[model samples]
Target: MRPALYWIRRDLRLADNPALHAAARAGRPVIPVYIHAPAEAGDWAPGSASNWWLHHSLQALADALAARGLPLIVREGESLATIVELIAETGAEAVHWNRLYEPARIEHDTRVKQRLKAEGIDAHSHNAALLHEPWTIQTGTGGDYKAFTPFWRACRRQAEPAPPLSVPTDLAAPDGARDLAGAVVPPAGITAPLDALDLLPRVDWAEGLRRTWQPGEQGAQDRLGGFMETALADYREGREQPAVAGTSRLSPHLHHGEISPRQIWQAVQTQLARHGAEGDRLDSAEMFLSEIGWREFAQHVLYHHPEFPDAPLNPRFADFPWQEDPGDQLLGAWQRGETGIPLVDAGMRELYTTGWMHNRVRMVVGSFLVKNLRLPWQAGEAWFWETLVDADLASNSLGWQWVAGSGADAAPYFRVFNPIRQGERFDADGAYIAQWLPALAGLPAKHRQAPWQAPASVLGDAGVTLGVHYPHPLVDLKESRQAALAAFEQIKKGA
Candidate 1:
């Protein structure tokens, strides 16, 4: 049998990886290769946290594959060039990979497959990233779904569970194959290098992230088991309280393809089935599943449109007037988590400090940056790209646009989130804020949200000086809302 190559991109796991399984099943020698695609070859590539996590995750993957007596060959530079040359060097008759849907990746993968076909080698791809391949969902009239309700309904109807694939027990590399020494790309965009993201925590407090998140098939299983044991039960309440453990926090795992949506979806389903849908546990499971639905919808849009990252699905807002200038003070404040709005600043700091933020706060801060500041959504997107560890093209684009009211079935243009109210409601008693923003840690619950409004004596009493320790609100909420409403009027009028 001719040797086969499994090119691992986003789907890093041995289990439930279509490419890995197919390559193993080829009844021939299988050499699995992970090509760290040259998206950010120089200074323009991956973020601090993503790079940090990638390093650790890849290490875990290598250890796991090594344990199973397999070698995950690493390659750098143009993926197609590497894979094609790889096929030639190894005398491989077939190349198998899980598909990716980003526009740039689509173009690259298409060219790779076309070239492989010309050379008489089989290049097969599978839908391993999403639970339902984006192409599969459609409307009653055979059109792509423009709204999430219809898209999600179509997804739920598939009903057949996405069962996990068993790990391959053994594999062999190509004979005398020394053409590849496993080079890596630089941390995106920069020409000269630092090291692989599979390496460090770009920041601190990551001992928990490091401890909680291990990035491989086995690690994903362990995380899932632990969630089922303790946290999955309180996910609903936890999701609401940023101070507590509520969400799966497995987004980065899914983003890195360290785990599959199949694993997560099935895990949630199994847990829910065991519980009879009566209380917070079941409600939380349902909510988390819906979050997955959003992920599905993002892919569905990306699959159909293919131009999502650069363009908006809702075109009316495409050319909407946005202020662009040399300096963005508001943008600066927002990015640094110094906006002085307790909730907004806290969320930004969380993102900067931890490379992750509570989802509710993600919405609030995103809205403040884009709408309240009358800034471009892409600006926020760019900042998010650099900052978030869980920043996925599909999920991040969908989320940024949704927050900006420029995505399909998005939050209405008029429904600007009141950050204060959101914090007060979801984070009642101000515990979440205090946990993240320790300057306000000493404030009584009632005064935490609007600390600046409290008397100067209150600041003195807490040993927190307002202007010295923290800035006051950059813009008054009431005035900012009026300005945003005005901008919305113009956007609605012409956009």
Candidate 2:
């Protein structure tokens, strides 16, 4: 059998990995490799949180592959040059990898493939990132679906994916006549790169992220199992309540291909089969599934519309006047979880300490920064990029657009999320805030919901002083709401 090189990119795990399965099936010695791309390769880069997770994941993966008697080769820098060198050294005729839908990635791989084919080498790419390839789902005129509901409906109507392929334990690569070994290390003169290359939280305060999430394959599977067993029953509840473990926090896993969406989909299908797919699981499962769709949708949009990430998706919003970070104080306040807004601060602090945030406050805080503070969506997007372990380009960008009301299928410009109302409604008992911000732990749950309104006596009693123990509401809701509404009105009216 011809030798094959299995290039590991985002897909990190051994089980249910289609590209890895294919490479091993040749019964050749599968040369497994991971190419650590530069963190600063692009404008929208992997943030600090992802890098921390990535470093540890690499360590975990190397150990896992070594246990299976396979060397997990770690290469840093340009993949094409390294692959060509590896192919020549091993005398391999073919190299296989999973497909990526990002526009830049597509361009990069296409050039690499063409270059290899010109040299008489076969380059294979598999669709393992998404359930359905971008071109597979289409509209009446053979155009891509722009809106999500129709696209999802079309996807649901089509045949589901074939069963996931399993990773074979015995695959090996044949050694070539020429001795070939290129151990990879950080490239020459790369000083203090961003942290996405390894697995650690961006913000250091998260005992929750450390306790709740594991960064490797085992962690991914354990999270899936835990969600299915304890938290999944109330996913909707758990998802929105930052205080509870309600939803499947499998995004970083899915993002990294540690666990394929198909595995997650199949898991949901299996559970729904036993649990009747009707009650909370239905809502939770479907809710979680919609998140997957959103991921696909972001990729779909970026794949088709190359400029979607850099600029506004809607053309008219191009000239929309928006502020960037107001000042270090403002951005710092938001980052340190002292926004004087309880839920926003809690979520921010949660991200600061743990490198993760609940989806509910993601919108609330995203809106508050963009809509209320009148900052640019890109600003918030970048913060999430740096802070969120699950930060994804498509999801993060599209989510910011949705919150900023400048994206496709986005929330209306007028619909600014009222942080106070949102906090009171979603985090009713203030349990979520109290969990992260211990200074307010003694306050009655009601005081947490509205700390500014509590009388001085109540503040003194709880050992909480407004703007001291906790910052007072930095931006008032009613005034900020009207201001945001006015700004959005201008954005809509082309003012």
Q: What is the TM-score of candidate 2?
A: 0.92
lDDT of 1 at 416: 85
Please report the candidate that would top TM-score against the real structure.
2
What does the lDDT come to for candidate 1? 0.76
Q: State the displacement of the C-alpha of residue 287, model 1, in Å, after optimal TM-score superposition.
A: 2.4
Runs with alpha carbons beyond 4 Å of true place in candidate 1: 40-45, 179-212, 277-281, 324-326
The total number of steric clashes, by the backbone 3 Å criterion, in model 1 comes to 19
In model 2, the worst 10-residue window by lDDT is 185-194
In order, the Cα lDDT scores of the candidates are 0.76, 0.76
lDDT measured at residue 476 in model 1 versus the true structure, 0 to 100: 83
TM-score of each: 0.90, 0.92
Candidate number achieving the greatest lDDT relative to the actual structure: 2
Worst 10 residues of 1 by lDDT: 185-194
